[model samples]
Target chain A: MSEIIVNAVSKTWGGVGGVDRISFKAEAGTLLVLLGPSGCGKSTTLRLIAGLEEVDSGTITIGGRDVTHLSPAERRISMVFQSYALFPHLNVAENIIFGLKVRGVGRAERDEKLRKVADIVGLSHLLERKPSQLSGGQRQRVALGRAIIAEAAVCLMDEPLSNLDAKLRHEMRTEIRALQQRLGMTMVYVTHDQSEAMTMADRVILMRDGHIEQNGAPHELYNEPASDFAARFIGTPPMNIISWQDGAMLGVRPEHIFVAERNGVPATVRAVEYLGADSIILCDVKGETVSVRQTGYCSLPAGTQVGLEWQNRHIHLFDRDSGKRLADRAPA
Target chain B: MVAAVMTAAEPKTARHRNWATNVNAWLLLLPAIVLLGMFTHYPILATLYHSFFSLGRSGPAEFVGLENYRYMLDDDVFWQVLRNNFIFALATVPTSIGLALLMAVWVDKKIVGRSFLRLAFFTPTVLPMIAVANIWLFFYTPDYGLLDQFLKSLGFAGHNWLGDPSTVMTCLAVMVVWKEAGFFMIFYLAALQSIPPELKEAASVEGASRWYFFRRVTFPLLMPTTLFISINALINSFKLVDQLVIMTKGGPNNASSLLLYYIYEVAFNFWDTTYAATLTVTLITILAAVALTKFVYLDRRIHYQ
Candidate 1:
């Protein structure tokens, strides 16, 4: 519904650091997740887009309207805060329709929209309850309901799933993604959890130290990460890294560094992690360590001599100093 | 059963911490208990004992029954003073709390030199009330005070602030607000600061205008704090009487006298012991009511995460 454009948008907190020289654009109705570790300025960038924060320089445009100088209420957008920030004093129904009420929406239309949003967020029965009376998941749905009732072209979510427990987080993410797609509203979600971003976002803008390390589709960011930071950041057990001579860092997914019998390199098993499905083998070779995931929890013992080799196609090469992906110029 | 018995016995070993922890626990509680006994328990016993009889200098007091209470109901000055006390509480409590909230919100905004503004709001509270009365006395002077000087500049003569019956109560109200607003502002400021910034930001994102944000969000959120502060202000409004001595002397018609000042007059000025004790009971009753209301409404609403 809205195309968000950041033209040389930079937010500097004068001295220390914030999102600096950040410039990107999201096409209409697409979900763009700004993924990074905590304090990496992703949240600040989202706030800037929502007009909750003032940028130090440059312009932001949504649906071809410049909004750099506008306040958040004037932006015709809604934000789901990390804490949800539902008005505790207001009951669930009132919380949902608070935005419409403020805009002088007629009571009938407000009630209609409230019913629609509450139904959409599955909060129909809980409308009479205060936010304090609801469970964590229900509060989040109320927060989402508030956003949806606004019917703004763009919705900014700042780590909204972070407060929920893991199982509920997974469920909410699916529900949120489904809702976003069904409504076709532009969403910019900020999260430190790569899995959340990977599962929810159409495109992930991976950030580090106030800079965009890579921006691409989740699979693109995963399967062909543009930098070592992206390579190490995307995978769960994390990308196992080995520093070769002349400072090239060999990066590969844990599963890719599996136990192999075909022309394998010399190594000794350091420790074996017995996960139910697969066991991860931590190995040592020439005073360096690398983790390898083997299929099925094998009874691999410590001090076992092992050979380590990976699929040539799956190995990721990262530059020595720059840490940029050596995709095209990787060593043979 | 054996595991349960072992688990139950495990805590017995922990409870036997060799006198050191027992002594530490007692040490921590000792000061509070002793102070509570000395200040809280003894006073109640004494007040109850003293309430039944009249205390006379150098004599065992006689039980006066309901004579003191009966006398209080009929005393003209006591009725007038009681009326004046209510007027003082009414004028000061609501006005001070309202103005303090206004000042707190304004100062809490991103104003330039906000600390200086806060200091200005709180300056009178830090000053001794006697000194503040001295300051207001000079300002209230009919001929040469600041009010008269300003009025004279405008081609008008300011009436007697402390002397005029019509304006004396208002003057007292202004003085009390000046002396109390900043103190109340501290409570309001704490409550304001404790409100999560995201609450207002979320309201903004919800397209709530400033008034809607305040009425629906901020004020409702501040209700418990407001009630608490109002109760405190009410009790203090009835008790503090320094300005009465300096500026009014409970005149120019006993207009500005408070319950405490009236009690002071009865006990010390008129040399009436039993009746003063009766008024003291009245004062304690009102104070207790205010305290009870505060506890009932406020202490129950501790903000939860």
Candidate 2:
């Protein structure tokens, strides 16, 4: 396994910075995710570490070796693209063993590695079939097989499951986690999907506007965000950033808010979405929309008066001017 | 009971609708089928039929089975022209295709002045063949031509480019390749652009060298375009006799003459219609055979979908 250390790496295109001085360390045997919205430079950071995109200024060390100026091929890493990018002309086995053959490995060794990787990805029966004959999930497995067959210490995956259907994405996500754990591979995954970051990452670096807004574990990002942006971006139905008394912005997750009888600010229910296991209620509080997520079957009628309440510790106060968290605020 | 009654009544109306649809489809197809029959099928059959007859002067033509064929086999000029056509095809098709692929790759890459290079390469294709031949005639002129002047400046003796039998075919083949490669390059360029750029990035990340990526991924993916360009180049090689007429005129003892050019000389210049018809039949047969081999053999090996 390899520990990836990116130090103040910066890349710019035509005076517009794609990634501004960003630094993080993916510890050995940990799955680190670069999570952000589109155009937030998560993929750019992954590409920089893989040596696909040259860093304008900074040093990157993988396994303690400086690889900033090396070519992608010289870096000891493997990548799975978002599109799977399987060779259309090659069959499954050929696609998997292509890296080995190109490196001048012996045919016997290549075949042996191919079989092992195919078995791991459950693609043994499809070795002779072309990529055109495979389904979306099958093609994703082939891409994974290609990365795993190289046996690199650091594996980079750029939204590998973004092309698959929802059910298959869930299945493949779990399988990829299992595979990484079994092999002890240090992976740097890039995605805009926060759930993927939550369920798969040992550490998530949430970026915004070319800067790392917060870097911590998934639950830490969920419960304790560093800024208003992170507070609204990490969780499903996200956290509500409502103006508190004296113009302080308060951040609280939708799940933490309780529908009370008459203890707090009264709001009107705008809509209710009855998802099977969870129901989300949209409420209007002083012309600001706030969302409430509750466990199954919240059947409140529209335009009904409801009071919102939450524990004092759940309130995250932010400075109105800078959107940064207030240091002096304590739970009241 | 109601469903059974409806099903029984539906058959007659469905049959009537099917018949009406068939008639409408046939009406739409009539124009294309008729035009094709008049221009292509009729001419092919007429040429084959005329090959078996002899032209009689001042009298009705007489049937002569195999006579024209025997004469064609014995004619040295006909044999020479057929051999020359074969040589021209063998020289031009592969070289032009290779050059086209190379030029396409260079253009596809993000190089400086790429648009200008594309325009320069494709200029020869847009020029008419007769005009191109006229321009090349000046280049190949003995002693004072561009090629000879360059050679003379380099301390080498000047040689006859198109006049001598040894260098005539090679000069024509080179000119043909220069004209045709750019046209073929357009097809290759289109095919290359359709391949996702991610494949190249993945290959680079996988440690595949540029040449390895091209051989395993880019080249195989371009097979369908190559087949299409090759067929067009082959057909043009046989039919493109405009250059021969303008530059060589089948000169220096018909060294640069092609089969179609010879057929023109036989029918129009010498008034030998029967011999020309026999030669036309042979040309058609060769083209049909090539097309068949491509469909039956190459199509199986190069999967398009």
Candidate 3:
């Protein structure tokens, strides 16, 4: 019952640069991601839930307890910051058990917990090393160890993997997901990287301009975006959004479209991007740029004339003026 | 034969270039070396050399060879001033440092009129020591002084602050602390600013109270700055002589005098140049020992980022 319910939380500095009345719920034992670009107030929302920022209005609850006015510690939550914030002077072991010591836990219990957490984070051998001596990854582990050793029911992360390199980011992403599940902690992870949200989150809350643009499971957001913004924000190549007839926009995923010989929309092959597993053929339909994903190598040259087609079920229509998804399906 | 000769010439040219680089480096170092040797090294050596000699007030000076040292050991005024100097340091250093840290932490917060408060705290540091001493001297002046007048309003009797031996050292120490704490606060403020805000936020999230966070994290991280400020403060305690000259002048009975002021008195007023040189040598030895202990011991124990 460590579920967190953020009800209409709003925080702003002089009516600017903070979350609008954002509301969401993170169920117990589930990883919910708040995904957005910079300045979208994703971090602000997490900080609000963590009680680091006082909301201008509305209440936040943890496990049915209204913690809106409680301090960060009083909320009974742990957090991993983007910078990791390992104390430079304290060694790994001391850092892991710092919170326990702060709570006046016994020395023997602290040591036992330290050993277990050190092993879990794979920092047992490096316990005596100061943070300055550790590599970037190891320092991140120290921060993680510090956060998890508290055994708090709820944990919040603020773009924790943004500091790591690509390979390490991937590694930590999987490791963090596994650890979160193992501990059964209700976690709200914030990240600007949609791939991270898609890969690690049980539910993703996509934000825009301090408000939620869309909220759903990853596949739902990908397959059925609520608006044009959500369509272009997910997936690697993202969904192709082009102007359609009569004040509407047609949406199609890059993978859903295929090259057709005839009886389809007329387009020209603009370029080809060959990824290892698949090739993306860039095509110009009328005036809009559309990319069609093709398996294996795409031998189409830049100036080749081509026709693009997709199944009726793959096409999405949105009203041009509002950018909201149209309920009706397009003519097949 | 030509190839062999080409290889043979290379080492010689390389050696010549190396010699030129050495000379260039020395040329670059010339100005600083010249100034330090002329003003600092030469005076120290000259002081040490003169400490063993007689004043020769009546005739040519002669070698005294530790006579001034023996006389210093027996002089009551020397002992009194030395004791006063130590008492002055012990009283001023920690109090000023603590006050500076407190002021720095206060101003570091995002409070209303913060810049104004910082400027107010720093105003004392910008004043000349002579001006500061004169200002404090007026405050400590007997019945007509601001302190006594205020105390009188509180129904307390007027007391001589500087004229009395018992109160003079304490008065001077209070003035020095007031003048010096703001300058030290600048250093602590800078150190506090350099610490990442994330550390405090992290500690807060961990259920650590503000006091606990400061005690364990902020204070430990500030060790390097503390060590630096402490050493500077200690040396400053010994080096300060300007305020004493203006305020106490070694007092009615040499009660508030420091070693440097005593040396000044021996050298210029009494015309005891050799004994003054002896005192200067002792002062230099003490300062050197303090610096050496910091470098050899404290620096190793403290964490520097």
Best by DockQ: 3
Q: How do the residues A1-332 of candidate 1 rate in per-residue lDDT, one tens digit apiece?
A: 47999888788776567887888999899999999998888988899998888999999999999999999988889889999998887889988888888889999888888888888999999999989999999999999999988788899999999999999999999999999999999999999999999899998999998889898999999888888888888977778778865668878788877676555878888898888888888889778777888888778788888788777788778888999877553554
Query: DockQ for all models, in order?
Result: 0.58, 0.81, 0.82
Per-residue alpha-carbon lDDT of candidate 2 for residues B1-305, written as tens digits (9 for 90 to 100): 99889879798988899999999999999999999999999999999999999887768888999999999999999899999999999999999999999999999999999999999989999999999999999999889999999999999999988989999999999999999999999999999999999999999998888998998899999999999999989999999999988999887799999999999999999999888999999999999988998999899999575
lDDT of each: 0.86, 0.92, 0.93
Model 3 C-alpha RMSD to native? 2.1
Sorted on DockQ, best first, the list reads 3, 2, 1
Give the TM-scores of the predictions, in the order they appear: 0.90, 0.97, 0.97
- For candidate 2 chain B, the 10 contiguous residues with the lowest summed lDDT are B53-62
- In candidate 3, the residue pairs with backbone N, CA or C atoms under 3 Å apart (3 or more residues apart, or in different chains) clash, namely none
Predicted chain B of candidate 3, TM-score versus the true chain B: 0.96
Candidate 1 TM-score to native: 0.90
Error of 2 at A166 (Å): 0.5
Please write out the lDDT profile of model 1 over residues B1-305, one tens digit for every residue.
Answer: 99888868787676677567989999999999999989988876676566668766669788878877887889888888888889888888998898999999999899899999999899988999999999999998988999899999999967888888888898888988889999999889988898899999998877678888888888888887888788788888887888888888998777767778988988798887667777888888888987986678666764433
RMSD of each: 3.7, 1.7, 2.1
Residue-wise lDDT of candidate 3 within B1-305, one digit each (tens)? 99888878798887899999999999999999999999999999999999999999899889989999999998999999889988999999999999999999999999999999999999999999999999998999999999999999999999999999989988999998999999999999999999999899998888899899999988988889889988998899889899888887888799888899999999999999999999999999999999999999999999888
| DockQ of predicted candidate 1 | 0.58
Candidate 1: Cα lDDT at A190: 94
Cα interface RMSD of each candidate: 2.0, 1.0, 0.7
